[model samples]
Target: MSHRRPLPRGLRLTVTDEGPGFPPEFLPRAVDRFARAEASRTSEGAGLGLAFVQAVALAHGGTAHAENTEHGGAVTLDLPC
Candidate 1:
């Protein structure tokens, strides 16, 4: 599911998925370059997805966040209009 809210100067968008979610310890580093969750080490990619997202957000003067939910995970991006 997803939710979006208007901000004073931008918007707050959140997306949630039904999965195992992210590891508590890995949440903080999820946006780091080359960082990957232990469970997905052998999956694919160089783990730059979140890093790239964060970079884009920063470029737009916004921010990105990731966290584990009770059923899965959530990623939020706050961006300016």
Candidate 2:
């Protein structure tokens, strides 16, 4: 699922997945380069996905957030409108 909300200062875009979500320890380093949870170490991902998202958001003077919701994992990008 995706949600787009317009705040007074910017736009909030959130994307969510119904998978098992990120590991507790991995959440803190989810945006770190080459960081991956054991559950994902064997996956095809290089673990740079969230890092790239964070980079782009920071470069654009915005912010990036990732967390596990009741449903699953979610990544939100708050960018200037």
Candidate 3:
């Protein structure tokens, strides 16, 4: 991970990583409670992390999204204050 500077107005924050990317359809349900892109039989965690993130965004009038990165993949949350 890289050190993050305070966001600048009109500039978007991007988070990227090298990891297995989720399917396109997964985005629609990424915030669903207990919905795990990787089945519990294979993946770790109870799958609440993303849901929690989405909740925080909605609560703050922001937004969250997931997309395939050119090299790896990433999930991005944009909050306007």
Give me the candidate number with maximum TM-score. 2
lDDT of 2 by residue, 1-81 (tens): 999999898999999999999888888888887777775356598878889999999999999978999999999999997
**Ranking 1 against 2 by lDDT, winner:** 1
Candidate 3 local lDDT, residue 56: 79
Task: Candidate 2: give its CA RMSD in angstroms.
Answer: 1.5
Instruction: Kindly list the per-residue Cα lDDT of model 1 for residues 1-81, writing each as its tens digit.
Output: 999999999999988999999888999999899888895466778889889989999999999989987879998999999
Worst 10 residues of 2 by lDDT: 34-43
Candidate 3 stretches greater than 4 Å from native: 1-12
For candidate 3, the per-residue lDDT at 29 reads 84
> Of the pair 1 and 3, which is ahead by lDDT?
1
> Candidate 2 has which clashing residue pairs, if any?
none
Q: How much is 55 displaced in model 1, in angstroms?
A: 0.6
Q: Residue 37 CA error for candidate 3 (Å)?
A: 1.1
Per-residue accuracy of model 3 over 1-81 as CA lDDT, tens digit each: 322334554223456677767767777887778877757457577878778877977787777666776665666766675
Please report how far candidate 3 places residue 7 from its true position, in Å: 8.2
Write down the worst ten-residue block by lDDT for model 3.
2-11
C-alpha TM-score for every candidate: 0.87, 0.90, 0.72
